[model samples]
Target: MNRKQPIFYLCSDALGDTAEMVVKATMQQFAVDEVNIKRYHYIQTEEEIYALILDAQENGGIVAYTLVEPNLREVMKRSAIEHDVQAIDIIGPLMQAYIDTFNDSPKEMPGLQYELDAKYYNRIEAIDFAVKYDDGKNIGGLLAADIVLVGVSRTSKTPLSIYLAHKGIKVANLPLIPGIAPPSEIFTLQNTLIVGLTMDPNHLLKVRTERLKVIGLPNTTSYTEYEPVKSELNYGNMIMKQLMCPVINVSNKSIEEAAVEILGLMNKK
Candidate 1:
């Protein structure tokens, strides 16, 4: 068996959860099979902090520490020395890079910049909400989405959503169910850039067939039959047409490629 590479995350109290989500998502994107991650809370005592470091060192993997408090910086430095593994302190490098790149020309913000921050934050929250719940009823959550995807089941919506999120673009993906009426607002969201994803019928059937078997569902040929798959694609296109959405055939594309196409459309819009 290939040895699992451990990644220790010693994060400040404020940055842990976000960091964990980002790192785990990145690992999945890289298709890493063996990874172990651990998070540490902000520490007060030297002994307690040192014990955490000791445990990470014994785990014999890379350590990534995010320290916001200057007081704990020395302890972290010492731990890195003792661990003899690849260590990265997140903020230090990021700040250094920012200073090196943008130190010369500083731009002043407008008086309303602070107010606009709340607007942008709300937009991001709405995008996340829509990505999680893409049903037509929750189209309100996708109001802030720059790109919205509509497709049949198992058409790579979720992975594409994550991919777009990593690029700082809010993506919302909704599935099309044939014979079932879609939510109302999806037909009226003219401000949103919508993309419909379609796949080859034979390929779609094969994938759904295997998926159903894996989940111990009845291997009904409904999803895999040629006419049913064709109807699903047609229904998805009809939904897009009613919404004035652009359609993309993603059957031959990777998730990253699909995300890139979606982003390009957003930029064009």
Candidate 2:
């Protein structure tokens, strides 16, 4: 299409996650910066398709769409034909394949992947709570969390907390920085809710080095060195022993796996 920089047009009736995902995955097969994206959401009228088609033709762009509404999808097809524009129906091909093979049809409703129930809202609330209390922020309201995680840097605390939040468990993570006292709630919270997270020193060094690189910071500091990381791990273990709470080792485990262990401990107490 566009000789200078190809344009990728994504159209959808709801949020364009599917079409965007298709575009992104396809782009990964080539170069990362080869194309520029133009997203069009909630295509409700034929006039919108006509206007978008005109722009695609002018830019020599390809339109990839996931319009589940039958009438709107037809309008998009007709407009692309009238404008001599290249169009890709991202969902239609897959849907047709399912229909042909299984002799089944979809209800063609938008946003069927989303839930709006009490559990769903609770997850949203937990995610908010996790974000609010991440890294010991907003710990003045310690009773709000279902679980409190303490860990040195690069122990997968934040990610594990988020995974638990998605399962409707409110989680708070406190950083175990040397010379910095964590929230006093760590001492007062019941052993059930207060747990320590640790990781192998070598893995912690690698993780912290990569983290520093990502933020454009130097790794010359003691944060990523083996000895300092080992010292931090030892300190965390001592605190865990003193508090007599569960200690979860997150080395070589996924966020989901770590959450499962944390949840099991929470259930026990």
Evaluated with lDDT, which candidate comes out highest? 2
Alpha-carbon shift of residue 116 in model 1 (angstroms):
15
Model 1: number of backbone collisions: 0
Query: Which portions of model 2 show Cα errors greater than 4 Å?
Result: 1-3, 78-86, 92-120, 136-148, 163-167, 177-203, 206-221, 237-269
Candidate 1 per-residue lDDT over residues 17-118, each given as its tens digit:
545655676678776776677777655556755776677667765556655555565677776687664566755566558769988532322122235475
Every model's TM-score = 0.66, 0.66
Clashes of each: 0, 0
Per-residue alpha-carbon lDDT of candidate 2 for residues 200-256, written as tens digits (9 for 90 to 100): 898888888888989999779988778878988898888778777788888888887
lDDT of each: 0.69, 0.83
